[model samples]
Target: MPAALLKYALSRKYPARHAFTRRRDLKKRYDVVIIGAGGHGVAIAYYLSKYHGIKDIAILDKGYVGGGNTARNTAVIRSNYLTEEGVRFYRESVEMFQGLSNELGFNIMFENRGQLTLAHSDAAIRSFRWRAEVNQHMGVRSELVDRKTIAELVPNLNLSEDSRFPILAGLWHADGGTARHDAVAWGYASGACERGAELHQCTEVTGIETKCGRIAAVNTNRGRIECGIAVQAVAGMSSIVADMAGIRLPIHSFPLQAMVTQPYKPLLGPLVSSPHVHVYIQQTSRGEFVIGGGSDPYALYNTRSTLEMKETLSAAILELFPFLGQARVLRQWAGITDMTPDYSPIMGESPVEHYYLDAGWGTWGFKATPISGKTMAELIATGRTPDIIKPFELERFYRFQQINEAGATAASH
Candidate 1:
């Protein structure tokens, strides 16, 4: 063995650390108070410090950094959407992710292995056509592919007519792919800390106190913190956190579950999904088949996995790849999602003055982390919502102008 390995085997010695940040003591006040230290919060802090020159920020989380929804998600990244605004925003996000590793000085494990959304019915085929057209108009690399092309793309995939949902066509997206979820969070956290933003893990916000409508301070389990601006990015806990500031959001929380099969050789390549059957399958870098479906039947704020979802998701996966029946499932888990009626996130200023929102992420958040952070940072610095995020404003609900992405969002995230 090498000297490093021999030393480690004998006495568990390790090399010197590089640029890493640590949790620190909370202060009485900060220029900005960001709740939730997950990917979005950390990325927001990073962009604020790097781009806006606002470094006096604090990221407070009830749990350890990236231990929440950041790690729970499947880490799929794509920008093929139904709306022009959605496409533009997410395209910028995907572009940022393409160079994220170099910018953060951290390997985020971004695998650009493309994605395919299978269409099984006439309606699905038509929707795919419309979506592909829209995606193309917005400069997204998306198009409808027939069964013959899909077979050529993945030769081992099952396309037998005996299956209940026969393969008709697919929306092939060359830009869609996946990334390492935890690494993305850690990179953002490291960059933010290097820029002088503080991260306070295990620090939960208990209350949001206001004086005469403007921002005042936030009451946390550690201590009370006075801030001029308070931004909440608590994914599943959006409603509970916003209510503390007396602002109500149009969101319902539900548990979104997923599972992975035992490792095998690289059998799956691109991310595949069937909206008709509510199943999306992707092979991880470790050769495990990561499978997931729609949200749970009833809305609930829990992370507990269900056998019913497992069975349903498994059956759906088998319909597309019958050869996977022999592979055993290694693990299963769930993440809470704050779903919105329009299937779009609620960004920008809320009813409570000086309080910003990064809520209603639903299931498509991991893909939007960078863009959300960029826009949220710009919003915080300029006191105005960016044009890219204007369509997702909270007041849109009251104005009855919702950017609907239900058809594009329901089956997969």
Candidate 2:
């Protein structure tokens, strides 16, 4: 590892020395209070304190920091969407991720090992062209590759002619990759706390107190917290929070499930996915084969893993690599995702004047943590949403303008 990368990773270690111990009191008021201490909330707090000079902030979570979807995801990060806005926004995120460790003075353990989305059908190939063109137009490094290229990327890949969803081509995203999800949340939280932001775990937000159409304070399980501003970065509970403030966002809850196999020698390098198969697998640093796929057929808020999901996901995984059929699944888990109709985020102002929303992330929320923090910080501090995030406003539902990246999001997320 590079010296800078090593240094960055070391700083992200949890409960950094000199970190502030938790404080308990309802009398203290914060300038800003963000809900959900996952990667998004932590990053938001970090940017608010580090960039906007708003250090009197508090991040409250129902559990420990990053104990939510931040720890459950497969950690795939990419920007190879088939839409213009999606590509540009995520490309900016990818660029930020490159030096994020340095900027935050913590090691995020970002690995740009590239990502290949296999195409099994002519239609999948066509979609790849559109995605490649759109990504390239936005200055992103994405392109269509032939079977030979795919073979080189994953020599052990099974591309038999008669196999189900046989790989014919692929969309190669050169800049796409993965990161240590926990490290990201910890890095942001550690840095933010170092800058004087308060991180409170085991703090459950139960209600949003508003008066005269503006947020007055937050009612939590711990107690009442008076705040000047509140940003809800909670992924699954986004709708519940918005409803408390009488702000109806177009978001539906669904459970995204993933399973991992027992440890094995490093057999995979670049992240591989088959949109046609709807399954993705990557070997972690600990040698677990982290496996994940699309959302369930039904909309659900439950985070419990289902037998149907495991069977379906496993079938797809085996179809891609028959040799892995015997690999035992060590564990299966699920996380609730707040999926917007557009398959993108719904950020910016809500019905309540003092409440800002950074929700509707669906399964792709983890990848956008840093960018969302940067953008949301600017939005809250300047009282204006940046152009990049304006298109994702809640009002877009009325305009019927949706940025759906479902195709790209399904296989990899």
Candidate 3:
């Protein structure tokens, strides 16, 4: 072993450092104040400080970093959407994710295992075909695969024609993958802090004070701090936080639940999903199966996991892999998703001047972290909405121009 490694191994007490700066007194002012210290919030701060040279940033979260939806999500990444705009936007994100670990100087454990969305009927096949075409047009590696191809891709899948929901075809996106969810957030937060951004955990924003239709200051539980620009990137609490800025968002909150089973020998490779049955499954690097489905039926702000959802998910996964019936569930969790009418994110400028909106992420927030951060940072630094994110502007809703990704997002998220 090298001298440094030998010395460290021989030392009785190992020196360990915190990933990011510890809590300190909140600054009286900041150049930019970001609400929510999740992946999106920290990524924006990271880009702003590292790329834009804006060092005075503060990321405040009610809880610790990555403890909210960032921790709850099952880190599936893809770009096979039905809309042209969605495909283009997420394509950049997927590309960014491919090089993220190197850019951030952190090991995010990203795996390009690909993803297969099983089709149960003719309707699903049609939608997948359309999505595949759109994705292909955008240079994304997506295509519709027949039953034979599906079986070849995931041999263990229950392909019995006599099953309740027999697989007909599949949407195969070779670029689809997964990563360590918390590590992504930690990487961004650490990078931003190293670049002079402050991450204030447990600092809850209480209210927003506007001066002449422009964001002036934010009142938090710790204290009041003025900011030149304010961006709200709180995932589940997007609406409530925006309301504090006196800007009402067209958002409805819903709880999305997921569970993981005890580790076993790896039996799955590609991530699998069935939109018709509203469930997706992927085995992690730790040999545990992560299973998730659509958001809860009704709108709510709670993150409590439901017994009914547990039953539903168990049944759904069993239909696809009956051999996993004996695998014990380790734990289950839920995260609140801010759903939009069009099933797409609401990004860019809001009604309040100097206040940006990164709301309406729903269940697809984790996948777009890198691109959203870069674009939102560019908008804040240049005062011009990047062309890539123009389609997601808040004004689109007023003009009845929603991007409409319901067919793409469904259980595939």
Candidate 4:
């Protein structure tokens, strides 16, 4: 080790460097005002400043950066979706995630460990087959695998035929992986701030003022600031924020719970999920296993973890990896997800002119952070929606053209 490194490592107190700038004053005007300072919001600002040369941006968050759903998600990145639109969109996101660390000049700790979705019944087998075909047609590395291949891929998985839900087949997605959730948000915020975009933490958006059917200014707890464009990227609070703009969105908020086990010997590889049991499991690089499942059965805005969810997740994970029964759980938490009827995100133009929407991400928001940011930046900068994201516009709900992905998003989130 270098002498300076040794000295720093041995120091009693280490210096801390702030990734994003701290601004106390809000500007009177900006080219764009983005609500929510999570991964999507910061990524949008980063792309706007770096790609389109639009640096007059303001990112306002009610709390600290990346403190919402961005910090709460499990960080699974995959492209093996069912619908054509969903598959294509997430495929690009997977590709972007591969190079995100280098592009942002930050270590996001991205690992392409692949993902395995287990099938326990004939219906699940058929669904996996369909999704595999759709994914393959879109150039994503996804295929249906038999029990033999699954055993080779995940030697530790329970393959007992006498189990309640026998392992019939699986969907092996080689393009799937995971990354550090908060690091991604921090990287984008740092990059965007370096390029002159301002981030205001603890700045709450109170309401929005419009003039002639266009956005005029945004009212915050701090003060009101005029902007040419306003974009809402608040994940769980999408409907509430859109309501402030006098626009109603078709969204329902639900709490998704997850838990982490105490660090143990690394015994799991590849992300494992089973929709039949409604649970997913992945061991983090730190040796702690993350376990999560579908959203709560009811719709609510609170982020409270429940004992029932913990018991359900624990039981489901044991069904797939029986050896983990000895592992001790360290903590559990929850996040609010803004779900749409179709289980697909609503992007692009909204009913309010000059007020773009980036809402209804549900459980798949973190995986699409980069692509959503890039495409939304393009739309905001050029005043034209990109072709890649037009299919996800809010108009789809009005036209009854929902890109249904309920089957694809079941417990895989």
Candidate 5:
């Protein structure tokens, strides 16, 4: 199938019911006004109402709810990181995601299938060992597996001596998994709306009106929204939105591409990846094999897919699993990711008063929707940044207190 047709089919099979369909008169003064109705934005709205007792909230988006990165993500969730803070924070995120379906009273299809990241070189093995040790210390279910173990784990993978980027070992993360992307947004939207939060779609914010360095109102296509607090959870346009608030975030935009193969029997059991090859593959419950790699070497804001990425990623896929060479691809799509310097998101406060941030998600932000929303909610409602998210503040760049997860996030996220 073509990418659009396949996407339309998949979306129809799992349609989003909680889209922002109700048009309401803009409240003159909302306690909070969140921009970008993605997963992060909806999750924030839900947490604000449920946890913080703040009910008067408005979530504004330029497009439909959950139609941004929330719908475009590959949906991998895990916490087997190499850093203590990274492992700790993402471990919490994993736990939240594990029970997210039940918690949201909706079926998000959170799957805790194990993930295996292959190590093709001695250097890769060393990095895996370090990551496994750190993850274990942080109470994550990650371990180093040898070549024999790799053969048992994924019998069809090419581990022969003559293979390129030969599989020497793997970092097995038993806690890594995936979820239904749209369901997360719906759950949050439904729960938040039930708690009295208003959602407005087809609303474009053209300017951020401020006075005395404090947010006064937001000028939008619909009208000016008078608000007390504002958050930008718009994934691809994080920097653009932040710029509107006169904040210079250290975030860069890059396009990540992923594709699905025609349905086949469950040949791959766990999510498999390679840092050397910069590729990851896993079969979905519906039987399609999802394939993705890192971003193109160049930075781009485009969401258009390319034949070059498809050829390169397919080559890597065949290199790992040559048996699937005949299987045709069903679709290919691209999403713009907001990446920060550390490969970790910059959440919490900005320099501007009453302006908060939940930006810089990159390729890994979709899995972090619940956690980011919870943390940002706490910050906005309580007026204090949680310790878990304090290290990822926007001022970290200037303060030289960075949380670099590039090495660990590369293969796994």
Candidate 6:
């Protein structure tokens, strides 16, 4: 390689740890107080200061920014959802990601190679046909591909007829892809900082003081902050923060784990997943085989990986690509995901006045970061939930109007 190419590749070794400058002194009062400094919360600050012209903002997190779900996700981006509402909403998110690098003035390394969800049984193929129709009706690039096309797309896939679960067809989504997760969170944090937003790491919100059914102030480990509006964008700890405001949500926390293999020559391009086997696979830009699976069987607030789940995922991957069985495992990690009954995110208003919510994000939280931030900021500034996000309101549970995305979000998120 030339010297310039070598220099650029070497730059990838040392990553920028601190994404934004911080404020040592937390203000006694602010216009907005956002809990959780993950991608969603940070993006909300970015838009509030950049687009809505609200600068008196403070973002509080118990740990470092992007250290939670942002760092643990498989980073697969797609919009081929089951429902029309979901398809429309995620479609907008995918479109926003295409221009996010230019918008944030940072390169997120978005690779739109596409995604293929394999089908094994005849029922699975029928479901893909419906999903492809819904996706195409919403202007998403998806088609039902045959086994021959699957073999062409993934040359190393095991396509023998005698396998336990034979590959019949797949939903080929041309718009599905992945991006650098760290760069995205940092980009939003840096933009928010440049626009006069304050980021307070290691500052945990412990209590919320409500005055006459409205938010008056928030008590943190450091001190109390009086704010005009407060938001609980915390992913895993959604119930804890909402309880502080005298509201209870229908959410549970579970662990979602993923593992990676040693770097090898790049082979697979588009992401491939199997809902029947409960596994998803993608080759990263650095050549590691990035594999993701469904949430743990039991509910828990832990981030520890399990041996049984690893064995299950390994067996499924081997069925798809037997060549990877010999590759040594590099590392395994987990993140707590807040799951809801409908398998859809809980966004927009909560029961308490002046207290917004962005929870129940499950394994799909990373993909919705940009749109969630934009809509949540709009709701806080205008005091009205954006029309686009109305389908995901908290009252949807009581009204029995669930979006019912459980089919698509289960193993493929």
Candidate 5: tens digits of C-alpha lDDT, residues 306-363: 9999999999889999987999999999889888888988988888898998988988
Q: Over all chains combined, what TM-score does candidate 6 have? A: 0.95
Of the candidates numbered 1 and 6, which has the greater TM-score value?
1
lDDT of 4 at 378: 99
Model 4 alpha-carbon drift over 4 Å, by segment: 1-18
lDDT of 6: 0.90
TM-score head-to-head 3 vs 6, winner: 3
Candidate 6 error regions (>4 Å) = 1-19
Alpha-carbon shift of residue 82 in model 2 (angstroms): 1.8
lDDT of 6 at 166: 89
Off by over 4 Å in 2: 1-21
Clash pairs for candidate 2: 8-106, 8-107, 9-107
* Model 5 CA deviation exceeding 4 Å by range: 1-21
Worst 10 residues of 4 by lDDT: 15-24
lDDT of 2 by residue, 1-413 (tens): 89987787687664347543356554468989999899999999889899999998989999899998898878988888867878878888888898999998888999998998899999989999999999989999999999898888988888899886688899999998888999999899989998989888888889889999998999989889999999999888888888988888788898889999999998888888887788898888788889899877788878889899899988998888787888999999998888888788899998898799999988888888889999999998999989999888998888888888887787676
The true-versus-predicted C-alpha distance at residue 9 of model 3, in Å, is 8.9
Give lDDT tens digits, candidate 4, residues 3-80.
Answer: 999899778687555578777699999999999999999999999999999999999999999999999999999999
Number of clashes recorded per candidate: 0, 3, 0, 0, 0, 0
Clashing residue pairs in candidate 6 are: none
State each model's CA lDDT, in order.
0.91, 0.87, 0.94, 0.94, 0.88, 0.90
Cα TM-score per model? 0.96, 0.94, 0.97, 0.96, 0.94, 0.95
